[model samples]
Target: MNPRNILVTGGAGFIGASFTHYWLNKFKNDRIIVLDLLTYAGNMSNLSQCYENNRFEFIWGDIGNSDLVESILVKHSIDTIVHFAAESHVDRSILSPDAFIQTNINGTFSLLNAAKKVWIDTPKENNQPVIKHRFHHVSTDEVYGSLLPNEAAFTELTPYSPNSPYSASKAASDHLVRSYLHTYGLQVTTSNCSNNYGSFHFPEKLIPLVITNVLQNKSIPIYGDGKQIRDWLYVDDHALGIELVLNKGKVGETYNIGGNNEWTNIDIVKLICSQIDLKFAENSYLREKYPQAFAALSGDSASLVRFVTDRPGHDKRYAIDASKSESELNYRPTKTFEEGIVMTLDWYLTNDDWWQSIIDGSYLETNSKYMII
Candidate 1:
């Protein structure tokens, strides 16, 4: 069903912002209400273009707040909810698990309860049930934990074995979603996606961290041997996958979304460096424009790679088997890793001001702190 009134939590964050833009662009008639706490990672600038559209509205709030969430649901007459709000970083979760538990677990519970009250308890036009309501929970493949080199990729049926606090919290939330589906009959669908990289990604992530650090001639830190592998999905492709599941997927079903592009950590970093080198060589204007940044690319940017201690309980490898999603929903990622990385590099290179603002702490409060491991 086409969702007319939708609420997207964490719409100011990276993947959330991308999904918000994609949803607005795809469904011109639909209205989207974004609820975000605007935390350290949530940036308003990510959704700058959304302000021009009348169908878009933003609310600065937390999902853990039950009264606020319920009020927003009733006010907007929301029929669909695409939840993305969570404390997602592994390193941060390792340092402080309280936020992860609060935001990922408790916050999800609040959302589920609010959705139940609105979509199940409250009647619609003729005192009938809310027939078309859906809650699409955005989840991570990390919930499946690490896979051996010989093990098959994680599928929808993969059992949960979350490693870190972040993944554990997400696993708990996923369980809550499933319980609500079986016990309360709340219409719900879940998608556990692989690592996402592309535009508007926070610099704390692997891809953006490498790109930003390389541009600034800073050391590109690699954890352990940097051989840990991850299946990488472009952010835009992930957004599309979510939309497909929201509209075409069956209720109470889980879909695995992936780019089918897996690369080791070191390989990804070196590839980015190589791409930067080629870009600087090809574009004279780009080289002339940012001399220092360009000069940092004079030699191989890979020379800046620095081996660092790996974070505790780091997953060895994660791959996805999205055959179910492909056959059932006809979903497939369009961009290969090579193509997506180029687009990602070009975006970072061109949007210097965006990353610069982040580096300069313009968006973050003076006292704000982040676990930048």
Candidate 2:
């Protein structure tokens, strides 16, 4: 059944904001209530267009607050919860793991407890049948740890072998979600997606970091030998995959969503540089439209590449076997790596002001302290 009232946590962040937009556009009759803490990564500007829609509402809050989550769920009569709020960056988690543990593990526990109390316990206490509710948890493939060059892609049955503190916290949360399903019989679904890149992505991520750094003529830091491979899924396609799992997926099941597009770190950066070169060469449309932005382009942006120390517990490769999601939910990525990268680059070039705010430290004065790199 289509969700009528949905609570989307982290709706101001990159992938969450993109999914919010996608859902509102696709389901006109549906209402979205967004809950976010406005952390460094959460930018209100990302949801500026969403504010104009009457069906959308934004809440400046955290998922760890049980009272707030319960109030919002009950007040809105929310039937679905798309949990996305968390500390997602690996580097930040390396520097400080406290926030990751607090937000990823404790926060998920609070959300699960609140959902159980409101949707199941309350109804049963009132001598009524359990309310139909869905708690869809958005997760990452990193929870399965690194894959060797010859190893098969990660599937639904893959054992949990998280490496870094970040992945460990998320793994703990994933287990909590599973336990809720098995013990309480909460109607829930989970999707562990590969890396995502598209518009509204924070500047610290690899793809956006490279694009912004290249545009500003800054050094593009590559960790170790830059051979770490990741399956890159377009943000919009990932949003669609989540939507499919929410609507068509069987309860108490997990789905793996991937782009089927794998590229090494160095290769991805080189491609971005090459695309920028082609776009700014001679009298291209992008060059003509944004001359100032292209003025720094020397058609050799890749020269800025600098090898640096790799972070601790860096995963070598992560690939997903999404056949189950493909066959069951009829979900397939529409854009190949080539097409999605072009679209992503185009968006970054055209929407400089959006990311500029983050770079200039004026977007949110409070968030400035959390800015890394």
Candidate 3:
């Protein structure tokens, strides 16, 4: 019932920014202090609206720095930590696994260590009042690995079977969170979410990549047969799910948050292409602004579809059974995939300057300009 002083790690990134906005707008009394490393994906512009709020503060830093994390926890009297910082891309992980190991594995360990030090051990050693704190880890359904067409959707009890370096690293982090809860009595909960798509999405991901490339008449690459299925969750819905977990979920529990909407890779791309073509037809200015979107102007953005070799160890499918979260926490995704996709496309089309800055590497300049250092 009381206001919470929350620390959001990686709060400038896509989903993290959404959560930060959602919390600040909904909980006027709660103070949000963000600590992010300002990596390539962490853009200050994403949180531009958050700067005006007296309850919001941004600190540019890394989660691996325990001393800094400890200082923030103590200084701000933080009671909840939403951990979203990580090296998240699968392709980047495959090409360079070292960063994944460092950021996802060792970095999570460092964070857990700091939380335990400040929240658990400090009180015991100093005989001070115990701090009421919770650490909520944000994880991916990719940690469940590939699923068969008929296999039951991944549930909270599903054993982790990670296939990619990214998923493996996330699986390790998930274990670390669980271990901390059982072994060290650090109140912790985790949510493994399906693919998230919404505003401020980086252009490299599938949905945003397709939207950006189609607008530029660039090839929309499909891997292998492009039938890999993924359950898509709108980013705002994921934020709401986390809110439920933080407010209602039991400690040491893991929740699966999903949209219950699944689409194949190729189908998702084709859908985007068709939507872009329709948008161009309905709105004449789209074609004028994106003159290079010749395919869309001709009502055939599908012309740009190109099948490419699949990445190594690519998962075949991922689905989530969020029944536990639904029944227990009363969590449900409000947006259907169709509505979410339309909104996503509209966001990208309307906010060219946002993704364009990322594509052209100008976002880094924006970060440096606004970064708190």
**Top candidate (lDDT):** 3
Better lDDT candidate (1, 2): 2
Question: Which ranges in model 3 have alpha carbons more than 4 Å from their true place?
Answer: 370-372
Pairs with backbone N, CA or C atoms under 3 Å apart (clashes), candidate 1: none
Residue 319 in candidate 1 has what lDDT? Answer: 98
TM-score of 3: 0.99
Deviating ranges (above 4 Å) for candidate 1? 1-3, 124-127, 365-373
Sort the candidates on lDDT, descending order: 3, 2, 1
lDDT per residue for candidate 2 within 145-174, as digits (tens), equals 999987999999999999999999999999
lDDT of 3 by residue, 1-373 (tens): 8999999998999999999999999999999999999888999989999999999999988899899999999999999999999989999999999989999999999999999999999999999966899999999999988999989999988888999999999999999999998899999999999999999988999999999999888999999999999999999999999999999999999999999999999999999988998999999889789998889999999999999999999999999999999999999999999999999999999999999999899889878866555
User: Measured by TM-score, how close is model 2 to the native structure?
Assistant: 0.95
What is the C-alpha lDDT profile of model 1 across 1-373, one tens digit per residue? 4548999999989999999998899898999999988888898889889989999998888898888898999988898999999999999999999999999999999999999887887665458956568999999999999999879999999999999999999999999999999998999999999999999999989999998988888899999999999999999999989988987899999999999998999999989988888887788877776676743559578888999999999999999999999999999999999999999999999998888888898867521322121
| RMSD to true structure for each model, in Å | 3.5, 3.2, 0.9
User: In model 2, what is the error at residue 293, expressed in angstroms?
Assistant: 6.6
TM-score to true structure, per model = 0.95, 0.95, 0.99
